[model samples]
Target: MSMAPAVDAGLALLILGLGLWIIAARSNFAAVVGFMTYGLMLALVWVRLTAVDVAMTEAALGAGLTGVLLLGAAARLPAEAPGGGPGAGLRVLVAVLCVGVAAALAGVVLSLPEPAPSLAPLVAENLPPTGVKNPVTGVLLAHRAIDTLLETVVLIPALIGVWALAADRAWGARPGALTPRPSSSSLTLLAQVLPPFGILVGVHLVWAGADEPGGKFQGAAVLAAMWVLVVMAGLADLPKVTNRLMRYTLVLGPLVFVAIGLAGIWTAGAFLALPAGYAKPLIVLIEVVLTLSVALMLGLLLAGPPKERA
Candidate 1:
């Protein structure tokens, strides 16, 4: 058998095993661990499917940051005594039901038309004017910019909701830290060693995403992870939700995107359309600002709702 098929087969089995393990886990923490592993494996599956952008997103948010967030939640919760859940018969019934659902999903996938329809050719024809070599970038920034713009804007209300969870007295206080204890020696060492390299990688992702399989979301997630590490290692503190500077950072991307969209009406006779020759510069400008804004917003979101320390 060729190596590619073997890899795919093994990946599929590992994913299946982890999914079952998560469902069967006796402890929430163990289930979270299994889910995280499943997420990573799914990212690799995305790569095998030739969707590296989706892969980056899955590994970064779905696996890495989410694992960190849930692990923190688990640590804070009272320990379960571990004896009492659905009995074996119910478990068996549930398993059968899950198998049925999975079978239905598989049926849906297999029933899809062969040689799936794609807009790749249409995107290619319009891509040169966008100045980005990445087709995904072109689609996001040029063809369907409003969708991407709104996606960024949506984070604002999410952060607001998180902040609203704070007690009225905690309004100006920082969010709860994900990792509040003094760092272990090894963790500190990793924190110090990783950020320089991590920052470099994040910037490269944003910069190259304009021409390759990376973009603001993936790059920002990497940057956010680095900031998260710094906080977890006790090297820095997150700003208060009410801080003027922090709020500005949160909205900067959406603000700039909206500005560009309005400018487009004058420059190109349509919202978010690039001028005849300035496509590259405008896209780069948007990417750079949005990267910073996105990194900040995601970092804060992972830190949870703001509240005063007792």
Candidate 2:
């Protein structure tokens, strides 16, 4: 008997098993680890489907960044209590229902026709004139600039909301009577190396995005990883709300993007319409500011205002 099909089948079963484990696990930490494993496997599946861009994103965001966030949150939670109340029959029923729904979704996707015709030809025809080889980037930054501008507005206010919530004294109070000491040695050599590696990847993603699937969002995420790592390890303390730079960073993207949009209205008779010869440079400039703003916002979310430095 040929072993190729068997190998594929086994891998598929293993992925399913991991998914089930994540859903059914009683321990939050175990569930997070299982979820990270599932993400890695899903990345491999994306590669198998010839979606290198999606696979790269899944590996970076899903397996790498999400795992860090989940593990950190899990570390702060209480240990699971013994003798859980759930019965085996209830668990089985829930699992079966979940599997049924998943199977149905998979069947629907598999039954869909391949090589579906799209408006890609139209996009391709005009991409060179737009000065961006990446159709998605052109659509996002040039064709659909309004949506991008609105998204930045949404992000700025959301960060303000988070800072407001973190300001609540009761909510921000340290959980235990004893403040947990920060340990530098707790971070391994690998952790130290990871941030710089993430920065390199982020810069590459930003530059590559002009002609590829990667873009500011992906690059910003990679930069956010570095910010998160430094914050978590206590290497760099968060600035107080009183800090001028902190406030500027929080509002920078929206302020710049909106100002540019309004300027475009003056020059081009419509909001966010790039002037005849400045589309590419303006988009790149906006992306750089957006990346920095996103990194700062994510850092502030992870690290509340600096109390006494450890």
Candidate 3:
């Protein structure tokens, strides 16, 4: 009599309950809590499915980073006015759309072949050339480097969009703080105690990602979390939007990545292809720069639009 079945059932129930709570939650704060809990539960599901990389990503970005952003937004937003809720018809339409999508997804899953097709074997066979032991890392950095590059590039525009929210007068100002002023001593203590260890863990994740389940994204999330903690604790301030060094940090990763990809055309005969015996170092280089850029971007986004001059 294995407990695995019971555990799985309990986890599923918890996820379903949290999902419903998020959907039905009356307040933004309540909904954000439910959503973050749902994300953590989803990460556990990914772990149970043996997708450790996806689990780490879900926990880091889905639950941790996004939760912070939502919490900040909820804090800043005004309370909803009475009788300002959506119409009954609009709610019904939304519910119908949700059910329809759920049904379609269930049908697709149920219709899958007894043994679904997978390219895992093919990836395993060719993964050695990528100089990475982690199949996921190999795929992301070598076989599908172009896709990864594009993903990094997309973050730039998203950050720019956030910056664009600033008024003309606020263009050179620093972003607003995460937590309100008169910070609690407990938060300040936690910020001081946590970030040193967190930063080390973040760096370790990046260094180990080549051979293990961690990667730049997870590492960057951890680093960004530390930055957020520090800022919220009143130990640091976000750089002004017009700061030259900060602007350069924002785009450094993609620039270096593109340079490497272009160089690959001359060295390996295809864009983003690693030259023979050089894949490991090149991938590590990309990961390092990407971690910095992504961490800063996440921190800045959480910092929100510039509110006043530093």
Candidate 4:
């Protein structure tokens, strides 16, 4: 008998177990660990569903970056205070609400049409004008360019929100360091050894995105993770909030995208519509700059608001 079903069943069980463990875990750190593992398993599930792009994104942002963020938060929080706990009634109510939400979601999913709605055929028919082989890329960059642009632009405000957490007096200062203690020799060594390879992989993901199951976001997440690793190991320090170059880097992606879109109105009669024969180059340029901006934004957000005077 084929073992694929057995393997899939095992994966499903493992994911469900992890979810329960995360909810039941007493320590914040333990819960964060379980959440990370759960994210990884979900990534695997995406892979099994043949959604490689989503799988990469899940592994990169959902598992890797989010896990770090939660870990940092857990580290910063104080230990549980004696006699300061949620009441059993509150817990029971929360559990009921969660179950209701889950059941509703399951019902909606199960009620989806037998064939399901899809724009894939339309995307394939229209993709050639966008000059990209990957249908997902064509859909994101060409067919839905405005949405992608808005998504990138939204990160600026999100980063600003993170910065708003700081005291006014700390406005221009550096963010809090990622870790409190001195780095161990092993961590330092891994920091040195891993970033080079990680960077290459990140770049490859962006470069290959035009025709493959990769994209700027996945690349940016990997790049951000490497930078975080370096900072966590004491090999690098977070930049000052008021650094001119850093500010420029943060805005570069969105600025370029908007500029390209404006030029398109004159050339193609529509904003964000790439002119014929130049689509691929313009798309590649946007991807590269967006990767840089996103990587920096994610890293800075994880670094938290400015905590020390410059």
Residue 301 displacement (Å), model 2: 2.3
Model 4 per-residue lDDT tens digits across residues 170-213: 88888884753475999989999999999999999998999999
lDDT of each residue in 10-34, candidate 3, tens digit only: 9999998888889889899999999
User: Please, what is the whole-model Cα lDDT of each candidate in the order they appear?
Assistant: 0.88, 0.73, 0.89, 0.90
lDDT, residue 74, model 2? 81
Angstrom error of the Cα, residue 90, model 2: value is: 9.0
Which of 2 and 3 is ahead in lDDT? 3
- Mark the regions of model 1 whose C-alpha exceeds 4 Å error after superposition: 77-104
lDDT of 4 at 308: 63
In candidate 3, residue 172 scores what lDDT? 81
Question: Using Cα atoms with residue i matched to residue i, what is each candidate's TM-score against the true structure?
Answer: 0.89, 0.75, 0.95, 0.92
| Every candidate's CA RMSD | 2.8, 4.7, 1.7, 2.2
Best by TM-score: 3
Q: Is candidate 2 or candidate 4 better by TM-score?
A: 4
Kindly indicate the candidate among 1 and 3 with the higher TM-score: 3
TM-score of 3: 0.95
